[model samples]
Target: MAREQFDLIVFDWDGTLMDSTAHITRSIQAACQDLGLPVPADQAASYVIGLGLREALQMAAPTLDPADYPRLIERYRFHYFLKDQATELFAGVREMLQALRDDGYLLAVATGKSRVGLNRALDQTSLTSLFDGTRCADETFSKPHPAMLHELTRELGQGLARTVMIGDTTHDLQMARNAGTAAIGVTYGAHAASSLEALQPEFVAQNVAELSAWLREHA
Candidate 1:
């Protein structure tokens, strides 16, 4: 079915579409350990999943000096990429995206991932051509800020009122709110449903199946 209310469907990459929450959590912990900084608990590490790498690492390894940020970033990348090959899209994600595209929705990605990381993932997943546009944290403001959505909507020629941001973190929901757009949250990622509920998203999906159904019926 075609979408009536939303014209642009923007997605967050890590937890919303990709099954990389555990991998990301582990990688953050490992990066902190590599620099002898106190490792954040799983809850803390995962909580920063939708933020930009610099911001996420700063929160995850708060004890590190600013001068050592490059090293920390390098370590995070090293640990992250070691097993990034095993990361896969959540089940039904590809099909749902295809369905939305088939239904005339302008699909795009607004992620905290860097340009390099997102492009690599998109190529690896063979999903590059599926999107009409993309905005990366490195190229624009990170989540919880409206710049990414604002830029995406402008580039796609869509209005903020007719855009929806779907993601698995508070940052994502907050960004949608900041962008003056609607949001839908998925709990099968870094954050719990209770955590996401506070932001008042349009829908909260427990899994990709539920998300797909919601989008198909109501998006």
Candidate 2:
């Protein structure tokens, strides 16, 4: 497909646009430690990508008492917000987005993160204006639900066939499939290359550089 053929390109936050895996894992581990629970390692934390915080927390610390979930979530959020000011956008992300935008692709974000969390990241990275629209977990059904993608397509006044979803997890790929749009998975974020490939994205890029190339060819 020509780069300008797609009317909209939806993005997943966290591991997709930013390198927040270590920051997120460290914050969650600290929260678990404070609650006297075992801290999941980096690889384990990566496995929780694309799910809402509540679900990801449960998966990360399944041994924790169910009643303590709220407290754990609060602690994790507090620690994460405190340290996330230092979060950085992934290499080549800004240039890639600019390239796509200059090529006339409408950009949007569909993330499992809450609005506050997503806004904070965008502000920190000076990317608040890059997106034409955002659909967050707090405002819509979380992935792998297709609500956000569907909403974005409607909001953009574009059909699903003319849109694409780019993300780093199976949840994102599945969401795209569920919404009947093309999906591209990237491997430099939270999930492994083989794992994302198993979801059968239309294309899988090993890193941001390759992802930009793929977008150029398929967008």
Candidate 3:
């Protein structure tokens, strides 16, 4: 804790900072149901939480023809936004991000959400200015690919060695690895703790409180 190991801390959106995992899972399932495709189970649906909508749908409704993806995506968006107001950031997330920023660390987001979708969430939460930069799946390659992280670091003028990625899914962790950066996983989101642990993150926090504490002392 003597020296800050990271200059930039990038976070995944849906499950990491926001409490939208269940909502996303429900939307995916509902979309499949609307398309008469097999509805994915909660875990199955949640597993795709950190990928691009098209990639997620490809996994969640694999039986459906590729041409029908637009239909599924439309339905999924309908369901997700129906209760969008109900989705809130996990407790203490704002404070944690503010504290990090106040301490002079550059904060950014690398999310699976589309540019439009991410903009909506950030605007609704009034967190637009807190981020120094952001990269969405629609604007770059999806998770587990290095493009998003690479772009963010390059934009921020931060090196891979000076950046850390945080999230609640294996895709997030994998993306960090692919980008040659450190990762911290949170268990209170889409993926299970065991799954995140298998990715070998620097830390696994159970909640925002725990995550904040770890970052305070170690980031």
Candidate 4:
């Protein structure tokens, strides 16, 4: 196969890089409990991992009143903060990102997290300098809208064809499709690899090591 030269690479947060899926799921559940609402099943909570927090909460608890959205979010933030400070990125993520950066690829993040949440994670990880750019769901449209990817490419002056989206959710792949860019799906995240394959990603990596290897040759 011919090597595809990509000028930019965008990553999704949460389950994509940070191993925060379980934390997010637990936070959502805790928030629901605090609101006296039915806690969403693990699968249900996991399903919304790549959506904006409002949307994720709504989807996970459809019966929740809009008036309660603020409280729900507050409760979520409470539980999230309790554990977020202890969270860490997935194994090999730092090494992979550093390798990609060393190879001269412009790295950016397009995540469903709010700007504050993303900034907090960046600061905690102290890996902020590794990324060239970033877009948060609260600052732009949520995943699968392509708005974040479009803005990132435009702002960075990278062509759609030469830009790649690497994520762990179908939302990420669909966003790449909407932005007319290539996508590489990572299986060890929120969504299943089977679901990712149905989206026809340019490549499907089972782990960070596999993803890094693929990028080493084709990115």
Candidate 5:
């Protein structure tokens, strides 16, 4: 058996587990079109995938006024839900998570999603009970802030040395670094593997299968 290097494994929700990046990007574009704002490019839209909705909207559509945020959010949500019904979890994600859980590792989620949005996504899959705890951007500080990781570790009673974050975006890696924990980057998500490499994650998995193999050995 491999030695246990970590006891708490924190994951990111959208791009990390669920393959919802393209849907989210398109939804953001649709919302911009609905409001007659110039649509952001796909890269611009995807770059904000791990941020709070309002922050993401502002970054993607910088021409919009703050007062227009409410309507923008509503339209974005409308468009997202329209396509979200078709989005699915990445292949082998559930099985990998279950394997880690079976190995006695506590799993948790730290995401930029709101509590409501995260719960809705989880309710759609068999992953509702897989996470031991969760922290949301809406309920706590947003990514790159470290608050989410801090809260998750505190709640789990897990020390920083025994905790590791798994995510697809630089924000996720930065959050883990800020919280003084290790991180593993996944390439099959929003950010490019090269970009994630700058953050110096302990490992970079190209897909769920690779991620699972790394975790089996290290976590």
Candidate 6:
């Protein structure tokens, strides 16, 4: 049987669309310092990609008292949002998104960022208008859960079989699988190529140019 073409494309925000790992790591470290918790460095931060702030805080500061999770999340969000609002879009992202939008493909974001955080980044990068819709951590369940993708498709009045998820993490791939949508993993993000490949996405692209070409062929 032939594969169904995708009408909608859902994106993962941080590591996939934006090159804000350095800023994120620094913010996480600062948050930890403020909370008097152990700070995770760059490599450690990568492991937290695709996770909500509450989850990332647990991984980055495992020894913290369980009762402090909420406070930790608040502090992390406060620091990261203030600094990362100025984050840059990944190379070719704006052009690729414009092309997709111009082509009449539905574009949306399904990210681990809070709604406020996603809005801030989108506004800062001038990408707020590019997306037709968005589902953030604060708005839906975090990745590896499929709730965000499912909700996005429903909101767009699209079918899961006709949607594609574009992300850089296994969490995104797994979410796609759970939601019965196709997935494309990007290499130029937080997760390594091999790591993303391990999830067996329907496609994998090394960069935005490559991703755009693949989408042109597939979508």
The C-alpha RMSD in Å for every predicted model, in order, reads 0.7, 1.7, 1.0, 1.7, 1.0, 2.5
Q: State residue 5's C-alpha deviation in candidate 3, in Å.
A: 0.4
Best by lDDT: 3
Q: Give TM-scores for every candidate, taking all chains together and pairing residue i with residue i.
A: 0.98, 0.93, 0.98, 0.97, 0.97, 0.91
Report lDDT (Cα) of residue 87, candidate 1.
95
- Specify the poorest-scoring 10-residue window by lDDT in model 2: 1-10
Candidate 2 Cα deviation (angstroms), residue 209: 1.2
The residue pairs in collision within model 4 are none
Comparing candidate 5 with candidate 6, which one achieves the higher TM-score? 5
> How do the residues 1-219 of candidate 3 rate in per-residue lDDT, one tens digit apiece?
233799999999999999999999999999999999998999999999999999999999989989989999999999999999899999999999989888889999999999999999999999999999999999889999999999999999999999999999999999999999999999999999999999999999999999999999988
Off by over 4 Å in 3: 1-3
TM-score of 4: 0.97
Give the Å error, residue 131, model 2. Answer: 1.1
Better of 3 and 4 by TM-score: 3
Q: Give the range of the ten consecutive residues with the poorest summed lDDT in model 1.
A: 1-10
- lDDT for 159 (candidate 4): 93
Clashing pairs in 1: none
Model 6: runs farther than 4 Å from truth?
1-4
For model 1, what is the error of residue 69's alpha carbon versus the real structure, in angstroms, after optimal superposition?
1.0
Q: How displaced is residue 208 in candidate 3, in Å?
A: 0.5
Write model 1 residue lDDT over 21-105, tens digit each, in one string: 9999999999989889898999999999989999999888888899999999999999999999999999999999998889989
Per-residue CA lDDT of candidate 5, range 1-219, in tens? Answer: 454799899999989999998999999999999999999999888999898888889999999989999999999999998877699999999999898888788899998888999999999887889899999999988888989888888898999888999999998999899999999999988899998999999999999999999888777
